[model samples]
Target: MNEHLTDPASEGPAGGWGSVKSIARIYGETLSNPAVLETLKQQNKPGGFMCVSCAWPKPANYHPFGFCENGAKATLWESTSARCKPDFWNDHTVLELRDWKDHDLEMAGRLTHPMRYDADTDRYVEVSWEEAFSGIGAVLKRLEPKEVVFYSSGHAGLEASYLYALLARLYGNNNLPQSSNMCHETTSVGLTKVIGSPVGTVVWDDLEKTDCLFFFGQNPGSNSPRFLHPLQEAKQRGAKIVTFNPVIEQGLVSFVNPQSPRQMLTGEETVISDLYLQVQSGGDVAAILGLCKVVVEADDDAKTLGLKRILDVEFIEQHTTGFDRFVDCVRTASWSDIERESGLTEPDIRRAGQIYVEAERVIGVYGMGLTQHSKGALNIAMLANLLMLRGNIGREGAGVCPVRGHSNVQGQRTVGIAEKTKLVPMDKLKELFDFDPPTEDGTHMVDAVKGLMSGHVKGFVSLGGNLLRAVPDQRDMEVAWAKQELTVMVSTKLNRSHLFPAKAAYILPCLSRSEVDDQATGNQYISIEDSFSHIHGSIGKRSPASEHLKSELAIIAGIAKATLPVNPKVTWDDWTGDYSLVRDLIEKTYPEDFAKYNERLNEPGGFYRGNAAHDRIWKTPEKKAVFTTPDQLNSLSFPDRPGRYRLLTMRSNDQFNTTIYGYSDRFRGIEGTRDVVLMCAEDIAEAGLAPGQTVRLVSDFEDGRRRELGGLVVTQHALPKGTICSYYPECNVLNAIDHHDELSKTPASKSIPVRIEAEP
Candidate 1:
């Protein structure tokens, strides 16, 4: 327990009146009186737009208010009355604005017009859309196709993502690296190898029927609040919930659904987790291996007693491969190593194993915690092995669920925003668009940065997101960003990324998901895929923030038209006029998954994109799911040194990916600042530091670069000894650009090695 934590509310149940107050604060700050009520009523409704926040699935049964506090904040944040017109940019120079806080920059307002950075004046001057697009096209045409990278954020809708991908392929390169490369790329790579699917097999219906829910390294309360409702319901129905994380997250402890009038009025809370294990940082692989060891031992004992087999022998034999090797590896793992690495005793591991064995069905939910590590893919593969021991996957109420952060990150990938050439269907693409996409593999986020730094990539075009803040090694990224010959950002507002202008930079304003996108045909509806592999339509009811802003589809089309040669088969004009034409192209490209894409938009809850793993149909080369064994039990190995700790980067309750909403993390007892580091008291004292002491975190990476973040106040919290937690983007500098997962190349942001030094 965090005895010295200041905020008392952090110890209380999540949601309830606290959430209501937060929503009110956001709405009050951004929206007017009547519009607030209208927006609230329409949020997550059939005809209304999706909450441009977390990608948690919308419920089939609608509640009075379907959106969560963060979701409401995201909606109002986009719909804010503030606007950043030409005059505002003229007032502030790029150099002066670079020092402004990320939150302050975005709060300045939504961008109203296309603007170009004038290096001589160090200010952004308003420019016509045609001139901006033409200049960008001219520069892109000067470089080789592989020299330009097209980066997409998760916020892009499916139609826009499809067109963006098509534009990139038509331009002759597949350098379509997006935000997911930094987060869930491990899940995609690991799961594909294990179960023959990149996406999760679980659906919304599974949560309702699950016998047990295991949360690994994810805090749903802060990341995705609406997920708490399902956890509360699961608890009420006698489902056992277990959590394995370094911090004792408030959401995993208990929940009070704000939607439930009776519970809210009575102040009653549902206890969420039956067992909470505070696993050490980067210890998930060890913990999972321990559980598998216990299960295997128990099965061995049962076999000796001639009793009914505890393991799912029939399912294992029929549906899985590599089981014998996986079991052998688990059996060889020493108990002492597991306990020492996992920071959990033998009894606790057995206790959790017992719950898994007893539960008829179980769903393993995780987020960036398990993915942003050197062995991130192995971490996921180990979790899959744990579920496979009892055949928990490919069954009702059971599967591996990787909770995605952005609204449509998975959907963007599904539509074709990948750097890997093999991930996209080249034959269908060539047939439909009559162009041969580059066979050479393009760059992921890390490699893209390297390309920029080395001057190999000359141009960059972003669909959305603050790429500068989202990536690791901030200083290096900024320096690399400036090396680009041309940089184009298609965004809703000003961000830190825009401040780091290249030789030729353009910030083109685009319609947000919450704003009405009126095309030549009529008001357009875009489709977004949730984390559960469910695709649905989102139609914005609010008016556009600025008259000069264009739809993402239109901006993508504009770039396509200006850059690529006219293809008789490709119709950018028609697609821009009606987004359904873009959907038609998408359906033709992925006929199996997106058949009848436009018609399904009218369905009440949309439709499931469908995963072969759910039907026990493995798409692996061997046509069977495979159990994998890690070369080592622990994901990271650190020497025993004083003043050294593993730093876990996290988001505050008031923040989303790269976008800071406020300084306070309401759920975590943080207030008035985002520069505090949450450390265990034992670790603090051992490092000759006290609570509230100002310290600088220094990370010395294998690349021979020393990264440091200063002015971070040390605060005591409930975390594993020798491990600390701090908000991301601030601490992202501590992670080296090249320090990432071997297989997935996702940055190892969650477990960065750092030493705390007291600031004079």
Candidate 2:
């Protein structure tokens, strides 16, 4: 753990993307006892806190320490001895540090003081919090408010989330590029277009009633381990679970419940999945299409073959539009085309469709795997389409569920963080805050990055998040980031964002929500919305990381007070002193589920935010769930084409976003490396590539930029011919900045077109 302090030199095979390799290398050399336990014990005391990197919600009867390996590392990193003093920055230049490895940047440790970059010396010089804010405010005042884009990450709490939104509106720019833009933006784009909301309609209890669950593109073992217990319970009750993904994840295959006593003591594990389908990368579109085709055929042949109609004719006749167009869309799609694009035969699609027909109720579960693609929104819409064919929506055990990355990312958007349609009317804002709201649509991450890079964006502020690391073509991204006139990152421990400084930058340390948030009134509770749309309140059970740390809400209020002091129209002081006031304002502005939110959150586990779709009514303009028929997609025809392989970039079990937890992908038998690529034996030989050769992958995109993954270990895994799997961020350099969904702007990091061959 101590050795992780040094600069990173190596990126492992499968976990090769992040600083994990360097960190592991550090631990392998430095720490006498690399396995540092007692993090929760030290950080979970009466007041001190741990990092929120891997806080997977536990089961009702589970212990507080039920978190996985990543959680432990995050907690340890929080309470570790690593510190970034002024001397550290004084010792290194910003330009020089940018060239360092990803792991080395993180291992640099907790930022002790704020600093601003000196362009003349190309170094970061320490700046006081006051001086930093004033310097930043000067930059903001110099440009139009629209020139500033206020971004946020999930690490930020309710107070900070609200403060960021408020700051955006007050500063005259609604350009708030949030973490949601990358992670669950597809969920939002698809769901909101179908219904009125962006979150899943299913609740946790619904898992018990489901007859079958279709898990897609999500690796629970690494992404969200807490899901395993509920899956076990559902399995015990005999729910048929099917997993659809390009990679055969171990968590989906089987796992021993560490939470169970006998299993923990005896080293026994439980079986998880019933079926595994290695669908083509970015082929979620094809997979869903093929499944729907089988359902359609089954429905068509029902009368003669003793089959039941999978299409809900009655529901479609009454509650949908453009059924004829949808029917034609599916009917026109050929099986051969689906097979070529999906890398799965017609039989695989038929089998999956048959299972859906057999189950009385079906719940569709997905995550970033299905979202980070060019056709992601369409893929999500297709999942809903398949479920709707069997009348799955509004049922007790069936609906669309996206396992969100962070704890409360959904809740932030539900409140006032949104810069678009959910915005309260100008009259409402005037009535509540005595001001006019902005009419412009706020800039998302893609647009924000472009805006900043082009100099249209001058000032930038992030509540919490590593914006540069999360974006694609990472090497080129820093140049765009460095162009910001002013940048402020409100965070807990120091991260890449601090080192990726601006002309004027401030790293205002803040208290994690796990730590007690003190106010003039008393210890206050904050609320977060979960994957299942449950609105629960959380109060810090522990103390702040340090006395110098302030609540995110407090820090935001402080900035607002310092930056917007000249006007003093509304009571910013009221918000700074207490977060409850912000809650009250939320109630007034969006008074739907948040009515009496403060009082409601005080109750244990919070309450469910109403899902109107559960009642058999959608909030669409037509008031019914419509079948979306997107454009027909065919696999790479490879018409006399050569040396092409479909590459699907993914994250390891020990990482989240840009944070690498450790150096192992336990499920894949990948240890001490992340540089390996999973492929079929036929594809390797067909491309004339040997097993242990250094290789280069060229994107089929017109940009002609080549991605080289040197020294890759080739495995004759189950990955089908023309399909390959590699770790993300490392391959993100190949994904052009503009390569994304036109509607949602979600980075097509998963479904990039590339050709791989051994490097000579």
Best by lDDT: 1
- Report, for every candidate in turn, its global Cα lDDT versus the true structure: 0.87, 0.68
Candidate 2 accuracy as TM-score:
0.89
Give a tens-digit lDDT track for model 1, residues 1-760.
1212223438477898888888777777765445756877788778888888999998789787888888888887888888899999668899999899988998888999999999999999999999988988888898888889999989989999988988998898889998989999988988998899998889988998998988898989889998998888898899998889898788888778888889899998888888888899988998999989888998999999998777999889999999999898999999899988888888888888888888899999999889998899989999999998888999989999999999999999998889898889999988887777789888899999888878898899999989999888889889889878999999988999998899999999999887788888999999999998888898887788888999999999898889889899988888888998888888888889988988887566668889999999999988999999788767764454666688999888888888888876877888889988899878887788899999999995656788999999998888888779998988888898888988888998888989888999
lDDT of 2 by residue, 8-65 (tens): 2112111111223333543443241332443354332222232365323332333554
- 611: Cα error in model 1, Å: 0.7
Please give me the total number of clashing residue pairs in predicted model 1.
0
The list of candidate 1 runs beyond 4 A from truth reads: 1-11, 31-33, 637-640
- How well does each candidate superpose onto the true structure, as a TM-score? 0.98, 0.89
Off by over 4 Å in 2: 1-66, 120-122, 305-310, 421-426, 541-543, 565-569, 634-641, 704-716, 757-760
